[model samples]
Target: MPGQLTLQGKVSAGVESGCLVMESGGKQYLLVGGDPAVVKPGAEVEVRGVLKPDLASFCQQGEPLEVSSAKGR
Candidate 1:
């Protein structure tokens, strides 16, 4: 898992439609390419995925995380 990252956080609704915010490591990360319904607002979760630092995103959702897997923690 060269670029894989495991982060513990909570999901929040993004400013834009269909986008999600992951509050982790004292920062907010944007979640892309997954079923947003899998996570709920303010619910604690752990996400395993690759970081797409160079990916473009809307709002101030920090970096983009192309999540590979996620679950309630």
Candidate 2:
């Protein structure tokens, strides 16, 4: 089974209407179909989910893992 990964970062872009982008450790990740109430750009958050090997590929391929949860870290 895939293990859960937790990352703390700031929301870079995207929105609650659909997908969102988060930046952590100088890297950015696309948070697809996420809740807007849970996060926003410049807000610090802890995201829990399985990490994908190809970050860029996720958008074109399968839907990324659903965000298990998001909280202010």
Candidate 3:
């Protein structure tokens, strides 16, 4: 994890099939390891995680976010 980011933005529909997405600093991050049901669309949130490039998934949405923790603000 070379590029870790502490991002805060509104949760939105992920480009992937069923993933939570956050847009911050003009970048889109696909959040993994979180309950999709718990995160609402357009809800403001802060996510602490790292950008993982090698991680592959069904949801090839944007940058894969290896989320350590995420919470609504």
**Whose TM-score is greatest here?**
1
- The C-alpha RMSD of each candidate to the native structure, in angstroms, is 1.7, 4.6, 2.4
Leading candidate by lDDT: 1
Worst 10 residues of 3 by lDDT: 31-40
Per-residue alpha-carbon lDDT of candidate 1 for residues 1-73, written as tens digits (9 for 90 to 100): 8989889888888888767888777877888755455666777888888899988776666689888887887
Q: Give lDDT tens digits, candidate 3, residues 22-50.
A: 88899888887655554568888888888
Candidate 2: clashing residue pairs, number:
0
Clashing pairs in 3: none
lDDT to native, each model: 0.80, 0.64, 0.77
List pairs with backbone clashes in candidate 2: none
* Stretches of model 1 off by over 4 angstroms after superposition: 35-37
**Which residue runs does candidate 3 get wrong by more than 4 Å?**
1-3, 35-38
Q: How accurate is candidate 1 locally (lDDT)?
A: 0.80
